[model samples]
Target: MSHEVIRHATMDDLDALAAIEAECFPPAEAASIYSLQSRLSVYPDCFWLLANGDTIISFINGFTTNRPDLTDDMYDDATLHDPQGEWQMIFGVDTDPRFQHQGHASTLMRAVIEDTRKAGRSGLVLTCKNRLIGFYQRFGFIDEGLSSSTHGNVAWHQMRLTFDEA
Candidate 1:
């Protein structure tokens, strides 16, 4: 098995992606199996997974959007997907515990950022907990304090990485 960066995730990768998600986030914060199906079938280009020797390592997935804000609906609403949307909205980034601190997550994010730019979109956006605001800043994501759309009833900090600046 070879270790290399990959472009897109296939449906066969669901189980591995799910395993990483389970370990990294609570069930409430993680996307569901149905949501994964939606992502795989409808937005394959938006989902990406990295592997080491045929074993899944880390991944990041999201879709392009016309809207600037990342509302809760984007997570569960498959019908709301717009493949041609202007704003590249990222949903999640997860890496296996053993693979942490190895720059795998950052590698996947760079791919996503490049894809968003090639698509000629306006920008990339995401929402994270307050504690993670600084973490994203390191990647050049600017925090837009107090996002309006609440996820799981918690306050989310909206982050944007414009095509021009990021």
Candidate 2:
């Protein structure tokens, strides 16, 4: 396996990030360029990019908030991001289809989990379809069952991973 470098995102990555989001999700589920820009502007540090050489192949992006659950509002409202918040709310874990099954998404997810723990966050939260519940559990996430998010008018399940202090 080739080593992919993980780093924080920047304004320069706007186009690439938007492109990747489009490729990874359906139109109804994808984040718009404007929303992505807003997130990058407010909390780039929370957006982790996994790159193979200079091209980004996968990423895990989210914002921090006191809210324990992942909500639809957090996806569009950058103001909801609280840098000092206790929980990390993941908005997306995207990987280019060409790179699927290569473990890039898992690798990026682990990096996000580690970074969140180091930031002293109480836990990490996210929402996904039932199909992905098992996938997330491999990383210690506890499935909280169906979510209230009607963001894209699709059913979502909320999952959380809490960290214990050493």
Model 2 scores a C-alpha lDDT of 0.93
Off by over 4 Å in 1: none
- lDDT tens digits, residue span 60-109, model 2: 99999998888888999999999899999999999988888989999899
How many clashing pairs in candidate 2? 0
Task: Report clash pairs, candidate 2.
Answer: none
Q: In candidate 2, residue 16 scores what lDDT?
A: 94
Whole-model Cα lDDT of every candidate shown, in order: 0.83, 0.93
TM-score per candidate, chains pooled: 0.92, 0.97
lDDT, model 1, position 29: 86
